[model samples]
Target: MSHFIHQHRFPVLLFAIVVVVLAMTYIQPSGKAEAFHTKDELDYFALRSNMDLPIGGNGLFKASGECAGCHGFDEIGFASVDANGNDVNVVDDWRATMMANSARDPFWRAKVSHEIMVNPMHKAAIEDKCTSCHAPQGHYASKFMGESHYSISDMLLDPVAMDGVGCAACHQQSQDSIGLLFSGKLKYTTDVLYGPYDAPPPIFGSPMMAWVGFDAQYGPHVETGDFCAGCHTLVTETIDLNGVLTGNHFVEQATYHEWVNSIYVDDQSCQSCHLPRIEDDVVLSTGYSFLEGRSPYGLHYMVGGNTFILKLLKDNISELMLTANETHFDTVIARTRDLLQNHTLDMELTAEGIEADTARYRVRLFNKAGHKFPSGYPARLAFIEFVVTDAVGDTLFASGLLDEDYNIIDRDEDYEPHYDVINHPSKVQIYEMVMGDVNGDPTTVLLRAAFPIKDNRLTPVGFSTSHFAYDTTLIAGLALTDENFNHIDGVEGSGTDDVHYHIPLNGYDGPLNVSAKVYYQAVPRKWLDEMFDFESDEIDLFRDMFEGADHTPELINEASIVDFVTSVRQPRPTERLKAFPSPTSDGFITIEVPESDRMQVTMFDVSGRMLFNESMIVNRRFPFVVPDKAGVYLIRIESQRAVYTTRVVRQ
Candidate 1:
């Protein structure tokens, strides 16, 4: 099972095996500098000019029995809304956003408690990089972290989570139900959650507040796409620099399983294409507007990679417009480049029947749909785009894009234009845990708090503090089995817990173009180049709002001229293809395509992992099967589509 995957840790898998099949027949043109991010004129909001450096607090919330008599409360009864009973007010969708500033920001509670006390179940075991936006569904189910029901006073009674983040996280719900969960049980078994307002008559709020049902079972898991892989998939685990679990592997976030085994989960779902309700006319938010209020139900907004922060958090050019087939940012890279051009694939190898480099076939590509087919925000990167031809089309055996300095692999910044990072290098640890408004000494929350201060979050003022002062270190009262956590067993058991992706599928000979692409950009920058900053909107809002600091100087965004790819054939590959009773103890196998050509029958193994793929059109003689797992496999066949592969051993 030769396997390879990359997310930029340096030269890895040669930039997707050499610049993606020469970027599939070229199509350049995308050039419109100075300020392109228009969902209808977005500017976002700038200041800088006399820009006084610090302000930080007041983004607001504190109240509840005002968050602990004033700035310290954390619960709203686990703050919820789901099971399709929907009026989802996890405190008005976390007011300013960042899930209500997730506990007054201090750089996201000291970079998620310094990546959970430096790892091993302290937290961060994989799930969409920082939990598909911080605890998206709060780990499958347990009614918000369970111990009966989590703490830190609902981060100050959900001051929208001090605007750091909180809106029942990704639209609330509970019952997930896959395996374990006895003792009392009812925590998850399947409920409905699409939050805020997942359309269906009843305009906004009040189909009993618009939706949020429980007790389990709800509409195709809220419309499928696998319920946004339980928080866009950013899991965690692996340890040992003394943390233990030497089995090995770290860095977690599957981007929703790389678009669920690729070829766009048959037909999209993260909201049928990013929050699309079809619209009888669009316009709901009726909490009152016409003048006095507004907000009947449409602003889950959720679209990430932060188009420079929605150009500036939405004024409303129809909410940053676009959807005529989603204009970039995350449709998992235009639905994985239209599922690699409508399932464009081909492969072959033949023995007893003929055609053979000694006959050897093996091709397997299944990125499913997000969950890792390039799910979300974690410095995006996925691999595969092999091409091989012969019988006439010429070419034979190819790899990915490029980079071992051969360059050519910069899909903006390696897909999803993100490049500019620091990621809490290490040293911060004010743990005991007490996100906002704490008075102190209830034994600990990292010892009563107060370091580098400045609060209120969710975009606007931002500020993040703390690397040590954890009030003498109560470390959330210790115990994770007394701090020695571990759990590693995946790739085959297909269970390391969550946030997954495997990546390994190579087998080709003719008319082959097995594909997978999800390159998105707008972040990577040690400095700045977005093709020479186009000039100014304060250098494109300091490179789209603080991406690589020093107030923002610019220069980053390459690709001036790159070409040298050829191999386009209507007919030219066919060394000889066949697949008969050879070794079909009955499971099925018979092929002969000609009526003008167009075939495709695949099966794989030898560690490439694609069980089957079909499309024979019906020329008269076609029978296929053998997929359960008997023994040596690998078979492919394609037509004018010119491709053929071989290898069929079973006994």
Candidate 2:
């Protein structure tokens, strides 16, 4: 019987494949038939014809809402306090995160639309590649089918596709499913829900488990970086405007691979930071059989450094109402800001002897992320803004200042690229990745990106220049190697970059206040504005969706070099100053200094977003202005010799 089955195995498999394809074709929503004119469609057909794996077989992958109904709060809600003391609900927190709204992010929509508009013939592939990660359940459940979800029709046809990285997506990941380079290569089974625990208590009779009907099993892969690599690392195949292959593949975002060679791999996984285990054991839902015995579960609050977009969504909740409620939005926003405050970057400033009235200052930036600083998404960029001021708060020198429209003042008029050292107002040290087309010309459109024009993103610890040597050969026109990006020349072993700035003091005194800020922008003005310039309906739609968003740069961290010596004429005073309305929501602040008249007051929000800095003449009472946001803020009042730091809360 076995021999007979083996002899006819190929034929049976082929028959099954044909049946599945036919069934899928028939089940496809009416008026949503795919057109075959594009190169992507042609490639799809060829691949389908020659594919060894089965296609179009519907799997048991479920939607995020389905899982939430069981694992999260229902009519009877549950809440927990976050680091910021905000009451956080599990469902609300997860829903507000980027993982849940991956399909609904406006920047992503704009980028994908721009890619499709520029490379019309490859739209099918672009959609598939992007949706593979964003809408994994929709794509994988359809058996590696093409174009899981792209438009309103997709959302209407398959709601599961719009769930973003849903519950089933992560739980279903199998060892054999992930590929070497992470771009949504995951195999799954409906009957099994893999987890980090070696032996998850038998949950068969649990109410939630019974509803889901999946056996909980110990899957060690869940705890490794390899699991996150299944989607975090993205690779895109390049296609020229004329529909011809560029013979190049862009390693668009290699966060997973970057971690593999980093020092954190041995001791930490992505979960250690992003999904840190909470010390307290908590029940997800009451009236459940397995609720009481469960140990501390990893916090489902997958917060990341995406404050800009999260805030945008919160402001436009009427239009983009993905979160559970207003409280949920506020919780996620606070959590996002808090996560951004984690060890992302460190800045140190040093000044040498003044020469020719020019102060030579050295600023060193250290990357604390496991991957490249500002990694993931080519549109993201990070830079340092150094400023110097005299005792009277007169700006002596400044670098990396943004114009009114939020464009970084670059030496190049168009701000095409940024440099490292900044000795002049025109220079900005932007750590970013710039892509080039097949002609070696810079382009932001994803499909035409054949090579990197320049990528000076800070490397992680233990980064090897040799591991990425193959990228040089893979690049069509460039003969460059990985040395340009990695700083592993047997000298600088890890992800640290040093930049020197020589500011012309121009007769400025010795007590010049020197301060530097490290800022990060997920989507820069150039990329965002260029996307809107395209004359495509899809692009316009996304542009409209992105209106009123905070596209300006965000302050990641800031540091100031304390002045050691003060001028003898204006001696420093040691007197503590107090600010009134400590927890005021009225946006009114007052600082009182009895001894000092000329004092520098600089205020920064908890996330290091600078409000303003000014030298004020303080008498008995001096009124100050602060941002209208509710949060804890740090107020620094500096005199010639002593500095006073105080915290104020805006209720």
Candidate 3:
């Protein structure tokens, strides 16, 4: 016996060490990180554990009906009252949001049909990608299990799939399950329900809890933008018009990453802006625990800048009537309008009377959003509408005007590459993302987009020009010429855009009222009707959505001023030597001479180091590669035509 014990000493010691480690892990005191850490919580060993959950099974999530019985105010047998004498419940507010009825959104349905009809081979990928967010609950449960139907009609036919993003869909997003920030790699489970706050007190005789059998757990992912990115930031395969693969993965949306790269990520979160917390003390339901306590229950309205869609849904009672209650539609609209009007952009207007019977008005638009203005879906567009009129309200010059049918009237008729310099009444400064096909021409078909022909959307604060190489390469000519297209020239790192409008006074000398408004449109009329076919059911259905609907652009932010022009200011001559690609890569620069045939080009480093001092005849565009490392450089051009000084950055 003594000999046996001595031989087994090492084995016994190993067992004791294993036991100690297990005990330490289980008995560790809960800290703030464990209680509310928003980043990924999965360790190396548990990283792939989420895949083991029943994401492909319908039984993995309790229907919203089951949870709403206790969490909702309008559910039968539930009696939760708020401070304002109204029935208060999570479902009551959330159900009416865009998140609740995402699948039922007419635009989504019509778009899915149109895409599939356009490219039959892309049917499965498009359906899977869209359903991953629209009807996440049903899509995950069925698509992952090979039980999904690619057809939009079939998916809409399923009641379980029509619920869109329900309570179970978000609560089941465990830190261990969510893989990556986007592409809908979210995993779900019914056994555990996760939330931002801790300690969801259980009701004494709550049958709903007993039926769900969910262990309430605190998970910070519920409040983090990474979780939202699981659905928001999207990428899809690009296909061309000839049904050929474009070999480029088009960035469909980058709202989440755009916000992540901005300065707002450090201080504010997606939930902070969208789902604002409301302090309240109310009975959650009958037989509730902790009946009266100050709890920061976030408002679940989930209001966004989609005023047109929300109004359309509200007016159409037959479409998802129960999801977004008609009674709460007005409140949601008001909230959405307020968010767009006051929160998105800050505008400042300054004007001076110019010579040649013209008024020069400078409009600066500062992007206040965490991401680019009109960040989501590429279809969204936002532009400045600058108008000047006389005291008698007689229109003098107006840009960015839309016809009665809501079609942009001031845009180039031939759809010339893009517009940066809008000097004439027929020209307008439009801020939008225009996708291009493999041929480098603008195309509206999302799947056929190989690159962005034009993306002049105002960049967020702290925009890194390096991140937009594709845009710089393709649209650099116009981008470099227009300050509004590239704010980096004047306010690098600061997401503010300035536009100087030179409107011809045309002999009008009286005080002119200068007005500027920023209008946001979800879908441009040209894009919507470009590929539209009245004979096709899908196209007809899409067109029907706008019938009798308020499809007009929503005014995001506006500024008006009375420019008392008593005198005229002379117009400055245009800069002679033009520079293409101001932010030079590989230390290369191009200088074009439109008027003079001879000029002197001088270059200086940031430390005032003289790099290049040479005289050359520039009859045409001159290209030079400076032999300097990556840094800021100053270039001066002196010619018989004009003298110009410009700052250039080398990378």
TM-score pick, better of 1 and 3: 3
lDDT of 1 by residue, 1-651 (tens): 111111223233644664574354244466433333353434222210111111111221112111111111112222122323333332232232333333432223333444344443534332123432443223222232332342333333322332333323333334363112211121223333233333244333332122222211223454556655554433233343344554422223333344443334556655554443322232322222331221333334333333322222322213222111112223233333343333222222211111222222222222222232222333222323233344455444333344542222333221221111101211111101121112322211211122212110010001011212112111122212211111112122111111111211223333333222222222333212322334333244333334332221111111111000111123346544466766666557775555444455556788654565555464646666676556778776654434667777554
**Local distance difference test scores for all models:** 0.31, 0.64, 0.67
lDDT (Cα, tens digit) per residue for candidate 2, span 234-300: 7778877686887878877777877776778788888887877866545445445444434555777
Cα-based TM-score, every candidate = 0.23, 0.72, 0.73
TM-score of 1: 0.23
C-alpha RMSD by candidate, in order: 28.6, 14.5, 18.5
**Best to worst by TM-score, what's the order?**
3, 2, 1
Q: Per-residue CA lDDT of candidate 3, range 216-288, in tens?
A: 6678778777778787777778888887786778777777777776767777888887888767665554545
**Predictions ranked by lDDT, top down?**
3, 2, 1
What is the Cα root-mean-square deviation between model 2 and the actual structure? 14.5
**Number of colliding residue pairs in each model:** 150, 0, 3
Which candidate do you rate higher for lDDT, 1 or 2?
A: 2
Top-scoring candidate (lDDT): 3
